[model samples]
Target: MGNSFSELIKNFDKTRDYMRDFYIYGFKTRNDFQYKSLRTYDDERRRIESWLGDFIKFSNSKKGKQISISCDSSKIEENPLYNAYRCKSFTKNDIQLHFFLIDILEEDNFISLNDITDRILDEFEISFDPQTIRMKLNEYIKEGIIISRKQGRSLVYAKSPDSFQRLAGNDSDKITDMIKFFSESAPFGIIGNYILKSLDKLNNLFLIKHNFIVHTLEDNILLALCQAIEGKNYVSLVNYGKSHKKTEIKCIPMKIHVSTQTGRRYIIVYNKQWKRFSALRLDYIKSVDILEVCPEYDCYLEKYQKNAVYCWGTSFGAKRPKEGIEYIKMTLRIDEHNEKFIIDRLKREGRNGSVEKTGENTFCYYGEFFDVSELSPWIKTFTGRIIKLESNNKQVENRFYSDIRKMQKMYEVK
Candidate 1:
């Protein structure tokens, strides 16, 4: 069991079992999907048990033990979990208790039993039996190595800072920093469960235990949005804006947009009654109730795909080009600094348009009119970086100049 060959064989078998289960039945939590294949269950259980045992044995080894880990309190404070806890429906008592527990343990350091127990009772006012307290401490200790020193009749227990340092030092900090930075800085609409899950799995593997309340909320919203997009049915949602509106809308969710520049997530949906495309912010949707029946729109998915390109918002109209495609040629004079950005944008909106580099610092963008108006603001954004060279529609040029004039007048006033 200690040898490399033995470990390799054991791990290989465990991996094979996991792969078989994943392929046969996918992953099923206790509350979800009930139709589990016997083969999948049998394999999954074996793999999980094997992994647990291996991890335990590994923790007992010399290489797995540590004394301290490096952690930045400032970084943790800015995590999405902290924000989620603030917004989520957690009781005040629960929040206080959870924070107290975390504070007593002090993430990267070790603490004695007497100190921990006393702090818990004094701060949380909970007096558990010594045996029960020990049991609880042991559970967390098992997840990581606990360094202990004999003091009087009691053993002072603390996480091995060395072990923590080892875990933290090995790419965990980089990953945590990456996730934390992106989650906080990313545009509001850009946050999604896929990124959250990715961060969580990475943190779990690296033993970088951090808060995940926001990630949980993100997952719930993503699941509901996905269900709606599949034409499952109408959903009852409460808007979180100033008005605090509540309504049940039968919507055909068409597309999800993640802005590269802003990093926000937006869902474009066809509001049945409005008979128009609507952009909904994922975070503002308080709750969603799935419907039993699907939508009755014909070619809704096709229409969404055809129009959701190079567009900022959902506004595909009836007068859209023939067979739902309209083309427009726009010329822009871009400087060297803005050339890369414009090229990237053109690539993303491929087939909807084409770009030709006319000069050292100029390009022409010709694209179909799925939602040309949406591009107006984006074109204006490059005022200092680019100039509109030519517009197929004279009205478009006039509108741009009109907007610029209005902006100039507004800025001109002291």
Candidate 2:
């Protein structure tokens, strides 16, 4: 039986050698297909060999001297192949075994099989079966070396810290300890460092947390919209109307708008049946589904881009004169206290214009809007501080009065 096993091993080695030689020298084709295949095989073999070497090193580590590799177990579990073979016991043992090896390697800077099994049994509270340990280590080596290192006559093992911080060109034990501390405490430190490193190349700097639910939802919405657009599929969305009722609408998603006022993102979609552009709040989108058919309209993405500054919401479907400019000129009286507040409000609402000091404490503000309705409430915010000098649109003037009246009624107490 031993002779047969030896023969089988010899045969496998010979076969591998033959394939390696064939891949290196025997591939001569104009199509480049065979050459590509040979290159891929070589790459794969190199990768496998590298990982195997690391695994052997990791398995030979001593107690409290293992290399720790930073990896999220939950992420690994998400893969279907890994999930299938993953058992709770296996995961627990694997993590402990890796940690144990890491500790041993870090302490002594080298490890052997004898040291590893003994420490595994002692620290992990698992009875050491040499055969089982050997098999598992070999299997893990084949899988990948999450963290490991080679040393004289044996291997050292450890976990990869989440991130690393460089010391001041000084190789000190204290700095190494600090690196470990930061890795354990601040996993995102590495990510922040990378961002700062390439700040010069970035057009915009957006600092956000990965686990933030609102940002996650916004990203999902954008992804879905891009997918729909690429697939030429229409979408059915549920939106909250003026009546505050959930209204179902089938629309072709054209563009997405992010509002600085509320820090909320919205979708600018063309409603086919209604033949108009409707602004749908991303949060209010109850559900979205891809439809089979595409809408038959020349998408006005560029036109919307050019007129975004004046536009109110995404309702740009209404036809207006191309040369006409919509202006909402208003006079506001502000005390020294409210002057800064009004300017900040204007910037928030994205109303572009200039503020000129008309009086000692008052200012004349002139702004253009595609729809004055959108700016009415924003203007009305300075109820006591503002008095309308002229309003071209009666609806806007009425809305300001209505808002003021509502505020007055709240204080009426009659």
Candidate number with greatest lDDT: 1
Tens-digit per-residue lDDT, 1-414, candidate 2: 232221112122222332223222333222333444655443433432333232211122333222212232233211111111111223555666655655654422444566668887777677666666555555555554324467676654443442233322465445444443332223233323333333322212222322211222233446677678777678876666557698888888777776544545678876657655667777556567777757453455454567666676554524552444466777777775756776666556544666777877767777766666666656666677776645666777777777778888999935
What TM-score do all the candidates reach, one by one? 0.45, 0.43
Tell me, by TM-score, which candidate is best.
1
Candidate 1 structure, TM-score to reference: 0.45
- lDDT tens per residue, model 1, 328-370: 5566666658568767766675445677888877777777664
**Any runs in candidate 2 off by more than 4 Å, and if so which?**
1-219, 229-250, 290-299, 313-326, 335-350, 412-414
The per-prediction tally of clashing pairs is 20, 23
Q: After superposition, how far is residue 28 of candidate 2 from its true place, in Å?
A: 74
Task: Give the clash count for model 2.
Answer: 23
lDDT assessment of candidate 1: 0.52
